[model samples]
Target chain A: MYGKKVKLRIFFFSIIFLAILLTTFLILKSLEENVVYFISPSDVKVLPELSKKKIRIGGMVKKDSIETNAKEILFIITDYKSEIKVSFSGSIPNLFAEEKGVVAEGFLKDRNYFTAKKILAKHDENYMPPEVKKALESKK
Target chain B: MFNIFSPSKIFSITSRATKYVFAIFILIISVGLIEALFLSPKDYIQSDSVRIMYVHVPAAWISLGIFSLIALLSISILIFKNKTFSLIAKSLAPSGFIFSIIALVTGSIWGKPTWGTWWAWDARITSMLILGLFYLMYIVAWRVISPNNANKVTSIIAIIGVVNIPVIKFSVDWWSTLHQPSSINILSKSTIHHSMLVPLIIMTAAFALFSLLIFLMKYNTELIKIKNKGLDRL
Candidate 1:
């Protein structure tokens, strides 16, 4: 049998642990919308109504979907389920390229159109040498 | 086992161990640096920029590991009323705080070139920043609170802080963060190539040894303080 002191300590520890767990859960749940860094094209497409507030759209740069002129750059971001057109007049990260992951931040003009004030690149977790990458591509 | 926790005994053992830990730490860290900086292959996409992973990832892992350790020790102190455990936790915290800062700074530096931003309020990043704050608070609690009450106060802070560790680990999965999902998976195959993984593992071991060295030095000093106060037992 456990001593009275041990029982009391265990009860106290459990109470504190559970209280912290519940509080963290509620806090994270309340901040769910904000914690999501960006929404995909599919999620944006199904929005009940469009607002003037700025939002970010994240996906891959649809292969060969880029068009550039002296003034602005145009590209399509696709999540494989849906696609959105993005236009930006700012400098892009070095990692931004066709068939690479990207996130664009700005306002939504329509379900299909996005005007981006900033373009941030996203990369996958894979790491290898350039030669190994080339060899993998050649094998494919 | 109880005798080992005596201040005089721990002081003598740690003083001897510190020298060996330092020598091994220097040797391993030198090897780790060479492997991470020169021997490892560059990323196919990010190229040389990926080298920053050598420092950033290990610092993050160490900080998280150390915080978890401190929490466990705090729990032990609460249940057992062990002053030795409290002293150990106190000594371990500063290195954990330093490593968390290192992780945040290195991550921010890496983000600028790769993510196109210096900072983002994404789930993973925000949780990591909160972790750094928690470490700061824990260290400050030790200093601000009176010695008689410092143990109870710091233990509560540490236990509460541990809730964030799981959140930090799962943030990438739970939300759409700018940070990528972890490449090192214990339950599955890792995505990183062996060449890069080798250097990462070595660097992690080296960092762990360095933290141990720091912990020993801090702990020995605390023990010496107790000895000077003419206490044989903590």
Candidate 2:
């Protein structure tokens, strides 16, 4: 058996540890509804009645699927299997491009349509742009 | 293990090694700086701003690493009654706190340019902030309590605070985050290009060496103070 001080210390910290664990569990449980996850278009298709809570839909930008008006930009996010139309009024991220990965956050108006509040473009790890790649190829 | 590193031997090695660590730290840091500032390619998307990751990620890694070390040292103190474990933990806390602060500040700076906002309640950010807060609380516990009482109390705090480490590590996977997923992976080929990855690795090495230098200097000072006070031989 350990000394009295070591025993007391362990007991003290065990109480603290349990308290922290309980607090974390309760917080995560309470915020469960808000823990949105990136879902592909096919996942959206399988979802039940849509709620007002915000969610993120992630996939590639379908080629030539972008349409821009004076105010709003409309695009389709595709997972190569299915697609969801996203409409946004705000400016998009710098990395946003056709045929690139993107995740849009907003409420779904329907199974086929998403009214986006934000657009985040995913950048690949490749540092060389196509043009730079071409230039380097020619140099080689 | 405790007797293996006698106080006199620990003092001799640390004093001798400090100069060498300082030299190596300076050399590696210089190379890291050059690579980060000039040699590394900018992100195709984030442009030059991506350079911040070189410092930010490494600082975060160090903060987590040091906290883990402190947790291990605390266990050694509590279970094995290793006399030198508490001193080692004391030596590590200040640097861990500094790294935590650096990680937070640099993360905020990176977030502003990349995320288009200064701060958010994203799970990763929130967890990192909590980790930094724990580091602050650990340092404060050591300072406020009497020396006789502080060792056990701080050890308990360090041991318990380890819960936050896993939270910090898995926060990205557990919740939706504005922060991107990790580019560097241990199990597979990392997503980052070698052009950028080289600098990041160099910076991380530099930071690790710098922490070693700092820990050695701090440990020597703490040991000297203890010796002067006629507390223990070490």
Candidate 3:
């Protein structure tokens, strides 16, 4: 059993704790735009002006839209509603493939074309063996 | 209720229990390693590199879980003014810090193979880095401050640090991070298959036991210090 002093202390601490939590929440909420790591192609579509500054465009690698050469690789990133053509000279990640998620960091040349300085693959949370994945694919 | 948590009683009980905990930890970890390394199904995409998830996920979970526990204990310390609670919180910190480091390092390694980079300034990863820094600050507070001041200072540090826990948990959901969203959900069906989930659960249990072992050892040392100082109560 707690004494009166302890109960008062508990109440006081809870108030302080809640205050701190609220302050943190507000700070993070205000900085929401800065915290977003990348923007999707759908987001890029409505951009009023194209800038030279580097930006990251993230979306799925469009199915059957990748073309490769010894000097560079070209791929179309699509968020279903919109698509951006990305040209990258750098090495692509192993996970980069058709219909898989990818993020390209570079400059947007126009509304439709992006020149990428780097490519990073993004994989989904799903995990399964090759055989099971094959079975799922077949069923689909 | 407080009588059962007296330093001498806890020290003796923990000292006796340590061996059994260690044995269980070793047994569980051995099986966990085998299951995680060999038995678990490889990812359809990432393949064997997905095995890193066994270590990375468990370490992150334990670090997050321990920080939350310490924060709760910190609140108890403030409310009850109990030395035992402070001791438990203090003893719990080192493992939390260690596991946070392990999580960060393992995540980096896992990231390189899968995400194609060792590091990213993404929201989820950045928030996790902040959590690790908070753990560092909490440990430093204990070492730098005097005993009487340490309890209050460390408790405040923990209480403040705990606000980041939810930030880390929800960062992926809230932001357009390079990291994928969570697969394991409590309220709904998990995306991860059963074969992988079983090993993950086993590894998490093993990691929990290992942290418990570390806590008991540290707690016992603190109790011995109290005894050596000739203080009968904590």
Each candidate's lDDT (Cα)?
0.92, 0.82, 0.92
Model 1 chain B lowest lDDT segment of ten: B1-10
The candidate 2 chain B region of ten consecutive residues with least summed lDDT is B112-121
lDDT of 2 by residue, A32-84 (tens): 65654477899899988787888888888999999999989999999999999
The residue ranges of model 1 lying beyond 4 angstroms of the native Cα positions read B1-3
Point to the candidate with the largest TM-score: 1
Taking every candidate in turn, the Cα RMSD to the unseen true structure, in Å, is 1.1, 4.1, 1.2
Candidate 3 C-alpha lDDT tens digits along B1-234: 578888776777899999999999999999999999998888988989999889989999999999999999999888888778999999999999999999999999989988899999999999899989999999999999998899999999999999999889999898899988999999988889999999999999999999999999999988898889998775
How big is the positional error of residue B30 in model 3, measured in Å on the Cα after superposition? 0.8
Per-model TM values vs. the true structure: 0.98, 0.82, 0.97
Best by DockQ: 1
Per-residue accuracy of model 1 over B105-191 as CA lDDT, tens digit each: 999999999989999889988899998999999999999999999999999999999999999999989988889999999998888
Interface RMSD of each: 0.8, 4.0, 1.0
Give the fraction of true interface contacts kept by model 3: 0.93
* Inter-residue clash pairs, candidate 2: none
Fnat of the models, one by one? 0.86, 0.20, 0.93
* lDDT of each residue in A1-140, candidate 3, tens digit only: 77899989988998998999899989988998779999999889887778788999999999999999988999999999999999999878899999999999999999899999999999897888888899998999
Off by over 4 Å in 3: none
- What pairs collide in candidate 3? none
